[model samples]
Target: MRSGLLVSGRRGGSGRVVGMLHLRVVCPVDATDEVLAVLKAHPGVTHVALFPGAAIEPAGDVVAADLAREATDEVLSALCGLGIDHTGGVTLEQIDTALSDAADRAEEAAPGEAADAVVWEELLSRTGEESRLNATFLAFLTIACLLAAVGVVTNSPVTIVGAMVVGPEFGPLAAIAVGIVLRRWDLVRRAGLALAVGFPLAMLVTFGGAVLGSYSGLFDRTMVLSAHQVDFVFQVGPFSLIVALLAGAAGMLSMTSAKSAALVGVFISVTTVPAAGYAAIAAVLGEWAICGMSVLQLVVNLVGIVVAAAVVLALRNRRSRTRDLGRPLSNG
Candidate 1:
């Protein structure tokens, strides 16, 4: 069975609706006819091309089409059912900018609401890309944690917010959630490894930074200990869990809908960054109690966010399946 479906809808742009997807398919020579038929029959599909034996590596025919994003799931489903995925491959790429009247009409012809659409393949592709464990990911995490540590020592809420905004931890958390919903163990493992290594390295960097700052008389333990704004870092409770849950849900929604502005709120609402910073600072200061509590706070917030995102993604997946089952396939 196909993993999930994408909703197709119109986007408002000076009275022009946009939201088209460009697809490239490598198909076995014998299946080219069926694949071309599938593409040509879809109203949402505007441009179609076929190249016989064009894919040298795969030794197959190449097919390309421009279709409405909403029609992606159905068209892909048809291709998959024909054994295209096993014999060859299918790739979907979003069009960042398009200047075609045909594309606009294709969007209108596609069925469903774009805002309500959930393109599982696209979502998985995107999250998978973001969840990779690499230097960039590590650097962002380390810097974010260090900023959080600075925020703690200075009791600066602005610094804390900046740290939160800079952190890339949410990408892996969301990937984990999507992995669980999709039952993709590989994705789960990748996301888990990224988090496993990223957080500790970030914490370590902050720890070393704190030790140095203290030696230089730049950081005062008393400041963090006395700061009201920084107290939540070491206080993990039901309220903290609630905030993490809500923030995770909102973050997933923003990701699915491409409303990135809401993601900034998600960044600042969770306690992961602050907790990591506090734990590092506390450990350096020999305050074991605060260190333990800060560690617990980090765990709670991470778990809460992951669980909440998973629940939201699973629910959305279920709803998409239901919608797919109820709607009749459009025949162009």
Candidate 2:
């Protein structure tokens, strides 16, 4: 049996976190099917898929191999346990060697530390294109934002948090982070357009709903200028920014690590959409100062997510490279 190292990573989708891994191994083509079967038995892996390449094929001098995350641990164990002469298996030492080497190479290839990558045009485009899921998300975000606005006016925390959970905006935001990392310009565009359009749509719907509520006697005049009375008021302060940063970091980490996405509920608690919802209400009610605060809150949260995602991806890339080459520096 052959053995080598595997490094785990992430690939972002519209609302779900995607996992990726790179493996370095020496094994025969005839046994390739057996090798893959063994790897697929691991618990920590999901979305087990393969990308074939000539560079790493083991047989016919092809020098290529790939195993999915589901197969990770078992595959490593099999590699270690196998009697055949080959290279690559899962090990802490192997992983460390790969990551250290990648960091050094990246430092050299980059003119400077890799500045945060933002595929602006692509981001805008992908968000604009309509998809069934994205359209549904848009509708949900509108309803949630509207509900949040009402909750803020009524000074109801429960309603506000309910709106936050119901808001589907985070999915697209996560997609944008993923698209950036994968260099998937199409997805980037889709996510960007969704954000650009979704926010206004949500604001408009909520504003109209607020007006209707006021006319219907369900909403009172006192509610118009309401700010702190609302449970949804933006938490303004350094801590607010800090929370955004931490949430962003966690969100990105969830995307890159194993089973970490289960913590997405924690990220939703950061209150990004709720803040936006509140700000929109302020605008409808002509509360300029409150609106300003809400806007600031949203901006901070957005920046936090993007910045954190980029940092995590950059680190993962470096780590992947180091593992693949078995060195602290790329041959380049």
Candidate 3:
């Protein structure tokens, strides 16, 4: 098997973190030639090897390559398009340490920015994992809703912020956006189910908590009526939608970039958990008007966030496709 050019280097070592990707692919005998061609033609790729009939179970030849992270998405897309992912297999792992001058050169030769690269399979895998509806997910939702309930009754913005931090609702919301963009109805359905079940279940538990708090005189109709912060939860208007839209877009971008720190801001900015809390408390106090308004606010924010995230993801995918089209397969 022919290999890509590997420049000799004296800087070879081990146990050093580097910005690179190690891709192990299993290619059918028939497709090995085409797969090798693609790998060699791509300048970002280096240190390639081929082992004939190495992979079993799926039964294919094993091909491994070291590449710059910036070029990974394009190479993965190309491989998928060539049906290597179906007839064989493709796996990617980040190199924790690369002690090689050749690796450094490979990184420098790769065009494009690493931060801007979007690994479609990786993104989908991550979001899919987050969309699972399990006890852990329910527990987080319960705690967030309860915190929101306490915040609503005591008018404590601190408690509300804490609830936002604890909440995992955004996972499903983001999954929905990704689903819509990728046209994966199953993802959309699973994410939708998480929301549909999570919210109502949380509200039900919080409603029970509200009843107990009312009996203990910790919460009452007068307190809710007097709490100025409660007004924020009940008010549904243009500003509420605008904030959700902005937060949704930011949340998706954060996920794509893997900068989870930004997601905390997204959680706190949305009214979903708080609105549910307020509605439950209002219902307990027989304040139907407040409850109705709070539910409306919740609906508006959810719709706004989902719509905005979907739009952002769609646009991002479009731009990526356009860029890929304009870029040549070879660096030269």
| Highest-scoring model, lDDT | 1
What overall lDDT goes with each candidate model? 0.85, 0.56, 0.84
lDDT of 2: 0.56
What lDDT is reached at residue 42 by model 3? 84
**Pick by TM-score: 1 or 3, better one:** 1
What would the per-residue lDDT of candidate 1 be over residues 1-332, giving only the tens digit for each residue?
Answer: 12222323535433333566779999999999999888888888877888998998788999988888778888888888888889999998766556566677777888786666677877898899999999999999999999989888988888988898999999999999999989998999999999999999999999999999999999776776887887877887899999999999998998886567998999999989888988999999999999999999999999999999999998988988887787655322
lDDT value, candidate 3, whole model? 0.84
Candidates arranged by lDDT, highest first: 1, 3, 2
Q: Write the per-residue lDDT of candidate 3 for residues 36-151, one digit (tens) a residue.
A: 88788887788889999998969989999998877888788788878888899998876656666768777888876655666778789888989989999999998898999999
- Candidate 2 structure quality by residue, lDDT tens digits, 1-332: 22233343523312212122345444555554554554443333322344344334333212223323323333454555553235322222112122223223322433211222222222233333422146687788898888788778778878887887787665566667667766777777777778788887887887787777767887565755554556445657777767766766676555444334544564456777787788877776677787888878877877776666667666766655454354221111
- 47: Cα error in model 1, Å: 2.1
By lDDT, the better pick of 1 and 2 is: 1
What is the lDDT for 104 in model 2?
34
Candidate 3's C-alpha runs over 4 A off are: 1-19, 27-34, 49-56, 59-61, 95-100, 326-332
Best by TM-score: 1
